[model samples]
Target: MNGDWLLRGRDGRLSVYLPSGDAVLCRAELGPGGPWEASPRKVGGDQKLRPGPAVGQGADGYAHLVSWRPTKPGEAGLVHSTHFRPRLAALDWVPIGHPDKSGDRTGAPAVAVDGEGRAHVFVRNKGGGLSMVAQKEKGGWEPWRDLKGSDVQEDLAAVTGESGRVELYAAVPGGLLYWRQGEPGKPPVLEEAVETPVRPGTLRALATSADRTTLFYTDDSGDLCAWRPGGKPVALLASAGPGPVSAVRCELDGHDCTLLAQRSSSGRVAFAAYPTEQEAAGAWWAESGPQLPSDARVSLATDEDGRVVAATLSPSTGQLLLTRRKDEPGLALEAWREG
Candidate 1:
């Protein structure tokens, strides 16, 4: 269970993957709205599996996965998977281009699918700048292109906007730097980066639209802060631990919900709900749960009914526990499956 993870595929399937020996194993269900019947499969080959994977679904209905693939001991390269259907069969993993010689020193790659159904991958270069490879529409990959930035943090986030426009963000010394790619064929243009009120620890970003990109990070004081591009960063009263954070768009009671989840300092999972699409930091963050253990890794995806379904690893059993809320005001949590 070294490389354990979960994500919601673009087609509304909730998939979970874990590392087994040298391969990354996967399983998925249609949606968490009903009973879950998991179908397990292996995604990678004999390469060692990395824990976290960046997943995105293309317009063509194929889910793309990017993770580190070890070529030799201590040397790994960023690998990309073919257009595998997450709700069905297994993946035949393939290295995007030539493997980077840096080996396991590379960081995890982030992927986003354009509106044109092309996949773009971003990974950390040995020299610290970000390296990217674009998947062509006709069925191939372009040579790796370096998108140079100064002192870029390993983690990069991307989102697709209108017409497949892409917005990429990386944490820098002061704040974050972003780039906008108007079209798949054009080069990316760098934009003005801002200095935050406090130095950020790690970054979490999601783009709902071209104009509505959301960024979150822990301030130097360890309080969670949220910001949009060209907007001021505002701190949330919610305190967060060092775990990962993510947000998704789902429907609740006929309104759009921006659901944010983070691990608390005490190790319990905390969820905050913004009931509207036009979200302002600290506007209205509602919390609920059947709280999870401190070490649990949480994954969120929307069900067919447009409600949020969360899965976390149970500490005692090491099994994946599914949590959800019913149509009522209070959250009704349940254990839908194990492992």
Candidate 2:
């Protein structure tokens, strides 16, 4: 899944979750830039899981993960698991079933936690529309609710804004579809669809304000673009490769900035830093770190010190590789280390 895999906990430690074989494995930091765990630990129970699982951290510091398991051709069942603190033990994978009772066909799922500390999962339904289920007050989940749309493509992006309202975005045939919560803890209402050409599987959302988010995606020409609600899409710069881009907001030399990372066409990771919500100012791109498989996905997160940490999977060995931004100025990264 193009969703986030790297997450920094409230205690300053980081956790990287990835699909290994039929299971989800987690390699967590002993501390910030840790000597991580000696080896990865398997999460959930013995149940098999589909690759590209989507992970998100809640306001309460728990890591929530969502993935699907194939039951038959064109049919899969969705399951979810949460990471408990102190022991770092993951709860058993609980099946959430499908939005469509007749058939389980669905796109990759995306998860977001609202301000009230409830986790919400969104996935494309069998009808090419969107369906969502959120954690209930005490426990369990509400029935799946269909947030209708047409020709909704996968790689859905979901983010909870500073105000505790959750926003969701999806790519359709000729444009993008958006959903926004009128208030915290309320269901999101579908906004008028914006007409823009977004490459499928490349949409991502980052909250830039208390009630708003900036959507990022690659255009038809593989150029990076950003769009905010009630505004037109702004082209940022050309990307080195065609895929989803990872973004996180942090301080750079005392200035608030948004750091972006993506896999380059040459199998190397590229980075860029732009003033937060200042896409009109433009961005400069540079390549850094070792070259990985051209198809390897990259994700970014900030440490307790506000430094950016990056993680990707080794295609050949299926191991986790990590690097963090150096203390020096600019977007320099430390040497890659296996977790």
What C-alpha lDDT values do all the predictions have? 0.63, 0.84
| Stretches > 4 Å off in candidate 2 | 71-74
Best by TM-score: 2
lDDT of 2 by residue, 1-339 (tens): 546788887777888777887888887888766878887788888888876688877778788889888778767888999985523779989988888964765788899988888888999998999999898878988899998998888869998888877889989987998999887667788986888888888888998876679999998987899999888889999976788899898888888898888889888888899999998888988887787886588899888887888888764577677888899987777888887
RMSD, candidate 1, Å: 3.6
The per-prediction tally of clashing pairs is 4, 1
Across 48-101, the per-residue lDDT of candidate 1 in tens digits comes to 555656666655656677776656776666677754556665556777753254
Those runs of model 1 whose alpha carbons end farther than 4 Å from true positions after fitting are: 1-12, 30-34, 37-39, 50-52, 59-61, 98-104, 197-201, 275-293, 314-317, 329-339
Residue 119, model 2: lDDT of 87
User: Candidate 1: global Cα-lDDT?
Assistant: 0.63
Residue pairs with backbone atoms closer than 3 Å in model 2 (clashes): 1-52
TM-score per candidate: 0.83, 0.95
